[model samples]
Target chain A: EAGVTQSPRYAVLQEGQAVSFWCDPISGHDTLYWYQQPRDQGPQLLVYFRDEAVIDNSQLPSDRFSAVRPKGTNSTLKIQSAKQGDTATYLCASSSDSYNNQAPLFGEGTRLSVL
Target chain B: GDSVTQTEGLVTLTEGLPVMLNCTYQTIYSNPFLFWYVQHLNESPRLLLKSFTDNKRTEHQGFHATLHKSSSSFHLQKSSAQLSDSALYYCALMRGSALGRLHFGAGTQLIVIP
Candidate 1:
């Protein structure tokens, strides 16, 4: 089976610039997640959804970060007015189903560098 | 208040030696699921082991981890380290009773020097 896919493998942006990262999850997966991993750190959960409706996004920075899964299969995580701290890998992952039973399959991730 | 802590930032070991990476967690919710994920260079992290029951060792690909609820720890172990086993390992917790978000530790980089 095809794994989760992410676009724009690498992105370099000036501070305050806007960027969007896209993700296409595995077929039939119901849970999609977005995580941010700073250098030398583990991936931190930013937001997650079950078929489009966000389940948790408390960790997402509302002022500059926004995400959407309009159709439940694909997702987009956007960052406006990016800052230097936003330089990291944006990883998108998906699970087979909810109830927290299935292991997540991750995408290669979008490496973002904010200057 | 829920978080994970992996004690080792980096561990360098010779091949064929026993391996161990420390992990601990704190969560108020009941019935948490512990997980270990391995990430190779330039690749997305993959699940290596997960457990919900205490004292039962979960093993995969010769790597194993036992979750001890009493100690709030899940330490990953391997009998004989292989060069291929060198990677970044992350410890995570899944609060099954709550929203079930995967909370992760800062990861341990294992380098198996041959």
Candidate 2:
């Protein structure tokens, strides 16, 4: 069974540049999540989806960030105007069931650096 | 809203010594799921242990934690620290609604010295 997969293991961009991070969750998983983890810090939830429907996105920066899971299997998180504070690792995770006691499996994450 | 708090940012211990990392949480929900996640260098975080039952100890991979509703704490502990135990530990909380969202605390870096 393959785990969650994320593309572009790393990304570097200048301030005001836009970037997108892609995530392919585990097969048959119903829930997908995006988290931001700064250096030496824990992962912070940005958004989550359950079968193409966004469950929560209150933490997402509405001004410059957007996420979509059109097919309910793959997800993409976009940053319209990256800032230095956006320098962090973007992690993708998925779970078979949100209501169950099972923990979500995480991806390798995309390390982003904004200059 | 749910939040997790890890008081120690870094903990250093000698090999064969006992290990304890403090974790406390705050939430409006009565039944919250508590989790311990460990992340090695260059690796993503993985679940170490989790429990929703109050006062019931959950053990995995030589580590154990007990969810205490009275104190709102779920501390991670081990009998003996090993060199391989060096990693960043994060305590996370999930609300009782089973929404599968996690609120993580500032990580605690555990360094076991030989």
Candidate 3:
């Protein structure tokens, strides 16, 4: 089975610029998640959706970050104004089920650098 | 609130040595699932092993870990280290009540030397 796929494997942007990351999850997966991984750190959950409805987004920066999964299969995460601190890897993951036993499959991740 | 802690930032061991990376977690729920993910350079993190049953050991790819609820720990261990075992390892927790969220620790980098 094909795994989760993400576009623009790397991105470099200046401060105050806007950038968007796209994700295409595995077929038939019902849960999709976006995570931010800073250097030398583990992935931190940013937002998640289940079948086009956002389940949790409390960790998302409301002022600048927004994510949408209109079709329940593909997702887009946007950063309105990027800062240097925003430099990190953006990972997309999907799971066949919501249960804890089903481990999520991860994408290659997009590495973003804000200058 | 759920969180995971991996005390070791870096572990260096010679090939053929036993390996152990400490992991501990805190969660309000008792039946939380613990997972170990390994990420090689330039690759996505993949599941190494996971266990939800307290005190039951789960083994995969020569690595094993047991969820000890009494101690609130799930430390990854291997009988012998291999040069190919060098990678970044992360301990994660999935709350039984939470559907799809995973709380991850700060990760541990393991280096197997010859």
Candidate 4:
């Protein structure tokens, strides 16, 4: 079975530029999540959706970051105006709704660098 | 609020030595799932082990962890380390209600020297 897939494995941009990351989760998975992982740090949850409905996004930066899962299978996270602090890896993960014991699987992540 | 804490940023040990990576968590949910994920260089993080039952040990790939509700800890341990064990380890927690939303710790980098 194919795992979660993310496009543009790496991205470099200047400050104030906008960028978008895409994610295609595993088939049949009901939950999708976006996380930011700074260098030397663990993944931090940014936003999550269950079947096209956002479950939580309190940690997301409302001013600059936005995410959507229109079809409940694919997702896109957008940064309106990137900053130096936004230099980090953007990870996408997914899990099924079958059981609570199921663990989320992650993608290779998009390594973003803001100059 | 939910959070995970891994105290060790870097741990270096010779091959065949015992390994212990500290992990602690705080969450308001009564039954939270705890997970250990390992990431090799240039690779995605994969599940190492996970457990929700308090005090019941879960083992995988020679690594083991036990979730202790009394102390709010789920420290990862291995009796002997190998060179192939070198990688980044993260401890994470998810509230029962928030199925896929995981709160991860700062992570611990383990370097096993042969």
Write down the RMSD of candidate 3 (Cα, Å). Answer: 1.5
Residue-by-residue lDDT tens digits, candidate 3, A60-108: 9999999999989999999999999999999999886746446777999
Top-TM-score structure, candidate number: 3
Pairs with backbone N, CA or C atoms under 3 Å apart (clashes), candidate 3: none
Against the true structure, what is model 3's DockQ?
Answer: 0.68
Candidate order (TM-score): 3, 4, 2, 1
Scored by DockQ, the top model is: 4
lDDT of 2 by residue, A1-107 (tens): 89899998999999999999999999988889999999877788899999999999999999999999999999999999999999999999987764554577899
- lDDT per residue for candidate 4 within B1-114, as digits (tens), equals 688989999999999999999999998898899999999987779999988899999999899999999999999999999999999999988876457478888899999998
Error of 4 at A103 (Å): 1.2
lDDT of 1: 0.91
- Model 3 whole-model lDDT (C-alpha atoms): 0.92
Query: Candidate 2: which stretches are off by over 4 Å?
Result: none
DockQ of 4: 0.72
Worst 10 residues of 1 chain A by lDDT: A96-105
* Segments of candidate 3 deviating more than 4 angstroms: A98-101
Per-candidate RMSD, Å: 1.8, 1.6, 1.5, 1.6
* Candidates 1 and 2, the one with greater lDDT: 2
Which candidate model has the greater TM-score, 1 or 2? 2
- Going through the candidates in order, their DockQ values are 0.65, 0.66, 0.68, 0.72
lDDT per residue (tens digit) for residues A1-115 in model 1? 8999999999999999999999999999888999998877789899999898999999999999999999999999999899999999999999865554667778999999999
TM-score of B-chain for each predicted structure, in order: 0.97, 0.97, 0.97, 0.97
Between candidates 1 and 3, the TM-score winner: 3
lDDT of candidate 3 over B8-111, digit per residue (tens): 99999999999999999998887888999999987878989988888899999999999999999999999999999999999998876456498889899999
